[model samples]
Target chain A: MGFKRKRNDKEGDDDAGEEVREVSHTVKKSHVLPSSIKNKDQRSAVYAKIKQEKKRDKIKKTRARDAAEKKALELGEELPPKKVPRTIENTRELDETVCKPDDEELFAGHDADEFSSIIKRDSIPKILITTCRFNSTRGPAFISELLSVIPNAHYFKRGTYDLKKIVEYANNKDFTSIVVVHTNRREPDALVIIALPEGPTAHFKLSKLVLRKDIKGHGNPTGHTPELILNNFTTRLGNRVGRMIHSLFPQNPNFKGRRVVTFHNQRDFIFFRHHRYIFEQKETKQSDTKGKKVKEAKDEKSTFKGKTIARLQECGPRFTLKLRSLQHGTFDTKGGEYEWVHKAEMDTSRRRFFL
Target chain B: MPRSSTVECGGCPPFRALSFDVLGLIKVIEARGGQQGNTPKIVERWGEPDASRCIVAVSINDRQNNPLVAVGRKNGEIELLSATNGDRRAAVIAEGGAIASMHLFKKEQSELSSRSCTLLTCTINGKAMLRSIEITNSSSDSNSTDDPSTTWNVCSAGTILCSSVDGNEKYALFGGKGVELNMWDLEKRDKNWSAKSPPKNNLDIFTPTWFTSAAFLDKDDHRKVVVGTNSHQVRLYDISAQRRPVISVDFRESPIKAVIGDLDGNTIYFGTGSGDLASVDMRTGKILGCFVGKCSGSIRSIVRHPEFPVIASCGLDGYLRVWDLKSRDLLSAVFLKQQLTNVVLDTNFSGEEPTSAAANSSPNDANAVMENQDEEDTLGPVKRKKSSKDNKQSKKHRKSKKKLEEEDDD
Candidate 1:
């Protein structure tokens, strides 16, 4: 009786195994069952063949889908919608080409216009001059000198080197340039200038720096606001013109004198030719009387000794500046060629250190 | 009475299971289980050589219950890969500008017999497209078959930097550098929604100018959108009531790179360019906590694990770190050796783990090993305990010698 019951149990187990296999086969398309009533080795071999067939079938289906997508694209037809749009606007109609420019070409000239605007010298840039507080002795004097030279410049005592905060401050105040004097020990070592709003910061090494006391200068600054200001001076010709105008200012101003000219240095390049009002007397040809021609003229001249006065007039030079290439930071011969206004060798004969 | 009965047994003998050491060890084991032991391992990495073409957007969807990860590149290329084995499933080129954002949604009820998935992609130039994917698997016949098809549609044409769809996929929001926050009703297919302007604050003279990222809160009934601005402000807007943000909070003092909210919508997590990841309680406007360690660059993406109390983040530093939310401990950090812009986790991904080439020799692993050595050197208690025993023995010997000397004198 035990043997008979064991046989029944074995049959029941076999039935359950068959049911599980059937269910797995039905659920997974990749799973395949051997059909031949043969040896286990032969059944396994058939299953392997089924697996390979399924893989090949999958590859074939994928290829077909790819081909169909390509064909639909070529025909310029909209592919079927994935989701039924609840609103008409959500349904995308493929009307434009999918192909786009390559990355290199896409980003190549993206900021071309913006760059042109940034480098364009449209007006006199407002400058913010600052000095590192660590070298207070030398930095303050240098910063003060710079502030006096540049009209729109203001002095900023840097407490910390937080670039973000400095930039934020500049942006709020609408400063167009930021010049920071970095000192080593007790001497100024480098001048760091950044074009404000955005930046292409330039660092210039300092050497042979002569303070105002070392150079022959106007006894006192005129403190005059020029009626006209020339900005972003470029080329040797502009330098000559700037130097000639700078020479017109008197070494010392009379207490009552209001007319003055200023030449400011920025980014190593000199931006110059600012001036105030100047008055001149009109010239009149000296009149000679016919009665003075003869010897008796001496006697007549004594009677006409009291002369007539000429008319006084106001006059000044009127010239407009045509902006060309904008000079970036201070003039440095060893810097990048693109940073300079003139890439070729400059005419050094025209260079003047006075301004 | 129960306590008195236990006292009758002579103050219950120490229960081994109730010991502090056993409980502490159990807690540590549980933590380990929740960390690297059970967290989804990065099975594969598809790295791009040029870091400039880093991934700009990522979308994960289950098509016919098969996980698919789609990544959009800076060069306007969209790559779809299988989440299981990282197999290349499909590649689509959407040309105009770099892909700015991507969203994947599964249709609730499809007329077609097969399940359908939809992909919505937006380019930086404001062009948006919707692609439909259908997976067909038929097992009725003796021969098994599988087929996949895709359809494309143009949704909007303009410039968009970031875009997101609501939970029900009903409304879409788009914002960027110059564009103001705009909402579109997906059902009506129009931008007729009225929005209220942000209230003016005397302290902030300049309006929030540039919006970097935005996300929809996960609340179904109350529709809210959170926007992160370049000015380091996170603003929460209630769509139904007003156009302006109801609450504006200043986050880390750097531009916010990414923003996401918890499932309950009460806690919001934000990452900044300064490599700070912090969470804030929305109800009281209080900063809950910060996740610290190993993030040295701008965090590009932060994704919370759906099942675990951990968050995975990748940033400009190129390290993918998982932080435990409760313990605030770094679980695992893997260095990809390339600047990574985005990461997506496959919540339902269950497959044979694919060996990662970088994971075996990652610098993060070496650093972790070094850290463990340093910790052992500084805090090892075994050496201290041994030294204390030696000192005790030395003291006893000295005391016995003194006593002997006294006895000799007596």
Candidate 2:
């Protein structure tokens, strides 16, 4: 034997007590650092060698796994189960208030809720968009974009009139809802959506707003009603908020416009996006890879030709909204009862999600 | 704060009928676990799917050993339903203008144990009428049950915002927008005393006298009243002293929608539009604290159990929450599925109520009597025995649990 080693150092290795390689006639070098090594330079060199060996071992293990997978596929065996990574959403706490799909009570309640009339198409939603009392330069531009995004929406000037008076006027006008843009330092930072007449108002703290001119390769929105897509609004409170937003749009969507608006709520942060989608046939490598999985599953090595897939192009005015509070009725700054209030104390746990 | 893991309603007063006014229905939950343990089962469901008859106000009179609940609909109709079963015992068309409030009580001169009950209902436009229900025959069938008569109007002020009866039912307090707090003598049908609006604030802004909810502070005295305003202030009015509030406390920024008095007169429980259920010390004018369970909508009704340390709250959130008064913790909560307009607990909810607590000195005596009633319930002994063994612990739950288990053990 070329060398001798302590049995405990390489205890976990399967080939530990095997005979030394006949060609080399030598034992493997253990990557353990000796405590007696006093010199800093020698310790640094040993550490570097150990790190390199560990990297090589990891790469070798992955290579072996790949080889085994390839062999298994060639032998027509089942593929190994994929490893699932743990995420905050996957391990979120159980929310008791989550509305089940078939909850008749919740469904029956929705049929008689505040937004029911508008949502049921019994009355069309006529939105009166207005800015706060204070003037801001970009506020007009944002309001204009909002007008384009929502069907049957009109802009009202932010004069000296109070919100309660405005709401009363809107009620007389039979406007279905009111959207007030709150600006701070010349930027629209908040959006208040108040259902008209007998009201339930939602105040949203807006962030990361990108207007039509700001987004690159953004398309212009048309007058046709865009389809609404609400995602991840599962909780009871979320259901109410989702309905409030849902009633803002017209019932029948003009699919010909090819425009779509999405309110995606993930971890309670609503992401608003407007896009124009087109379904076209494209014979590219990307589509070929998708077909490969199908062909591989059937054990038929056939090539896929032209495939039609839907593609989306951004239609501007993208933003994120976090609900600050949802008030029961109209816009009474003083005494309106809030349906849901976002307090700092609610976020005590990282994995707890309301929506 | 940790949520209470167990429902503390096991040792509750015999009045275990917890009925919540859902959209068009009144759903009753058996809180005493008569048939179900731990889980409070829905014993009876009242009301139909008729949209025209939406419920607005509910008053349950289970106090005088009567299982009758008075339900006021939006069409200004009051229907008396059997609390035990969901049958229509009687229905009367009270002044039609959309019912604002309703109360079921016996006449002040009538005996406490009298079976004859009076119904008081008011409309939004301030038209109130009373219909006394007197059973024509003692063994009356469902078809011919009640003969209602003595209908009279007690209209005081128009656009009535809030109205409440004190413990003695001698005076009724009424307040509304632009209307000052007015106390009406129910017996004499005359105005006794009216509140004077407070002076303007430092900014010369007049706090609108829009009382969203009001309650008599003491069950025994009709002088002390707690009024919640649309302006989000809780005013404590001592009518014996001044016409204005003795102490006005602001709770958050939401309008107080429900006002109620606790066992002690000083502690008042209130629920704001923002779903904050908190107690305030009337003497010191300081907020005690908000209850642990968060409500998701404006609270419409908050009723404390007459003889127990528990309160039930319901509102637009459609959830009826029963909270322990001593610990200020949510003991049991149930989702009624409709935007709840009101919630009422049967003071003598179950068979647990002592048939004769005439010589009763403490609540413990009532609990001891409850043990004799629920002895046959096999499940009762298991729960009560566990509680009795853990009596050494100072936990309110254990005390309540021990109380639920009678000293006259099976």
DockQ of 2: 0.33
Query: How do the residues A40-112 of candidate 1 rate in per-residue lDDT, one tens digit apiece?
Result: 8978776786567567767987798778788888999986444454532222222111113453321222222
The DockQ for candidate 1, computed on C-alphas, is 0.01
C-alpha RMSD by candidate, in order: 37.1, 8.7
What value does the lDDT take at residue A344 in candidate 2? 64
TM-score of chain A of 1: 0.35
Q: List, residue by residue over A1-355, the lDDT tens digit for candidate 2.
A: 1111333234435454675462123222343443446888887786676568667867987998899899889999997766687777667766667898877767777877888898888999999999999867888888889999999999989799999899999999999999999999999999999998886899999999999999999999888889999999988888998999999999999999999999999888999999999887544544456765654534432343445679889997999999988887788778777667777656657776777
Residue ranges of candidate 1 with Cα displaced over 4 Å: A1-355, B1-43, B51-53, B62-64, B112-116, B133-159, B192-194, B350-410
What are the DockQ scores of the candidates, in order? 0.01, 0.33
Best by TM-score: 2
Top model by lDDT, which number? 2
Taking the tens digit of each residue's C-alpha lDDT, what string does model 1 give over B1-410? 01110001111111100000100000000111211133323323333234334466877775446676666765666666555555555666676667888887655546544344567777776666666544323322222122332323223433456677877787777787766777776656567443455656788665645678888877463378887877788888777777777788887566777888778777878887667788877777788888866355567778776645667777654456677777566655554433456766556432112112222333236465455445545543434544665588688899999999999999
lDDT value, candidate 1, whole model: 0.53
